[model samples]
Target: MNKSELISVCISDNRVCPMPPQWVKFEELLSEMGNGKPPQSLILGYWFDTSDEEKRKCVQQQIDWAYERGLLDFAIEYLTQLKPNQWHTGYRK
Candidate 1:
């Protein structure tokens, strides 16, 4: 899917968050994230389905960094392997 589609999926997946995260072109949005700023989890969360190609690519590059730091990337990578409907019904063939 394209960047916008990807972003939509990611946000929909994380609908539980009260302030569903969004990508920013401004420093102010980064500030709201926190002092250390845009923590890896938040950054990765904004990565998957962002509408901006540059931002998505940048975030993709940091997936390993986020994973190494024990943030959101770890779980997302694990769950990503479980493709849609592959787990359900037990066997496809």
Candidate 2:
């Protein structure tokens, strides 16, 4: 799937985000990176912030979606390179 299509799927899927507007720009940026480019640090940081169980599960779905579309390796590489942190909901505890 192309970037635009992927972004649409992500935005429409509640499993991806309850508030899709909050993720539109981020998804757009990710789309712009294209399939060949490595995921950027900003994307890594964003994924690292999925500290809540629900959000983590949503992200896991996203990873699976990307994997099905041949984007998993990039996602995995980006995620693996980031340091873990407590960033659940609006709290950074």
Candidate 3:
């Protein structure tokens, strides 16, 4: 899909935060990187869908840091989901 369509899907599905103007720019940037195909899961939940362990760790550390600084209202649900490896998949079949 095009960038606008992708943004509409993301917003409709609650993938990315919809209220912030920066999110539109972020989607634009991601679409550019993806050659117009936005990474759905990453845009949905960066901490949830990333496959790189280092990136996940970095994001978690940042969340922790933000919480410590009172910059975030961190939630346990963020850590409750199974690892990406455990997610069920049959879409490719």
Best by lDDT: 2
lDDT of 3 at 32: 50
- What is the C-alpha lDDT profile of model 3 across 8-92, one tens digit per residue? 3332322323222333343354445334433232334553454444342333443344344443322222222224433222222
- Please give the CA lDDT of all the candidate structures: 0.35, 0.43, 0.34
Report RMSD (Å) for each prediction in the order shown: 12.2, 11.0, 14.8
lDDT of 1 at 26: 19
Which regions of candidate 3 are displaced past 4 Å?
1-51, 74-93
lDDT score at residue 21, model 1, on the 0-100 scale = 32
Q: Which portions of model 1 miss their true places by more than 4 Å?
A: 1-21, 24-51, 72-93
Candidate numbers sorted by lDDT from highest down = 2, 1, 3
Give the deviation of candidate 1 from the true structure as CA RMSD: 12.2
Worst 10 residues of 2 by lDDT: 81-90
Candidate 2, 1-93: lDDT as tens digits: 544444344333223332333334334534555443322222345656644455545555555555665765565454333333312233333
Give TM per candidate. 0.26, 0.40, 0.27
Please give, for residues 1-93, the per-residue lDDT of candidate 1 as tens digits: 333443343334322111223223212333343233443332445644544444434444333334444444433533244344421111122
Error of 1 at 45 (Å): 20
User: Which predicted model would earn the best TM-score?
Assistant: 2
List the pairs of residues colliding in candidate 3. Answer: none
